[model samples]
Target: MKKTILLLIIISTIISCKTVKPSAENNVLVLKGTVEKMGMSTFQYGTHLLKTESKTYALKTAIVKLDDYVGKEVSITGSKVEGYPVENGPDLIDVKKIVIK
Candidate 1:
């Protein structure tokens, strides 16, 4: 009887556990362009810039070194940070993954 109850409790606990996902992953957006080191900026943010045919994005990442991908055309997956495009700058993205094209 005790063994049966313990087994049931363990099963319930396992089933009730929820997987945690990164907050940034929830707003996944993709951008493809050539990356370049951002020059001097008075209002613009981010360490790098991605220029596409239609738009541009300012990008920063804590997961990897974006400098390695500078001057290279790459596809990036990221989330837009809130309160961005400030001062007529490009949208800021928290880069999650980047792949050279």
Candidate 2:
């Protein structure tokens, strides 16, 4: 009886445990484009920019350090870091990786 109770406790503990998920705070998206322009300002993500084949997006959620990848053709995976629909500007994105392809 004691052994069964102990086994049950262990199983319950394992089943109840939760695993952490990666931060989905930023809405991740992918874009391919040239570094048409870039800038930094006192914003949420410290201000970053990219001009894609279709449109331009801004990185403005959390300060992203991507100065090393300016003026290059690349693919970026990040979240739509910031922006409002009415006042169209760049959507702040937290870049996951910059691939020169």
Candidate 3:
């Protein structure tokens, strides 16, 4: 009984750890980065930007006020808006969720 309880506890602990990893697949974009206000641009679409290690992303959202999380590292889950990245711009993501780290 004690061994079984220990095993169950170990499994539960492992499963409880949920990490938000950055990924882009099948028009779904999951990423972690620092949020910043969008600088001057010719195309006015997104309100903010997310900068990661390798790439930067233009971001927009109606779910949450992105202005609250500016200059902080965050994890984001969003969908790629159709017809973006025009003329060598970053991919535009319609953020559904934002979690500050």
Model 1: runs farther than 4 Å from truth? 1-23
- The list of candidate 3 runs beyond 4 A from truth reads 1-26
The order of the candidates by TM-score, greatest first, is 1, 3, 2
Residue 13 displacement (Å), model 3: 42
Candidate 1 residue 13 Cα shift, in angstroms, is: 16
TM-scores for all candidates? 0.73, 0.55, 0.70
Model 3 lDDT tens row, 15-70: 66533343445567689999999989876779999999999999998898999999
Candidate 3 or 2, higher lDDT: 3
Q: In model 3, which residue pairs have backbone atoms overlapping below 3 Å? A: none
Clashes of each: 0, 7, 0
Score residue 57 of candidate 1 by CA lDDT: 88
Candidate 2 ranges with C-alpha deviation above 4 Å: 1-26, 36-46, 60-64, 82-86
Candidate 2 lDDT tens digits, 15-53: 666334445553568788765445544443325577777
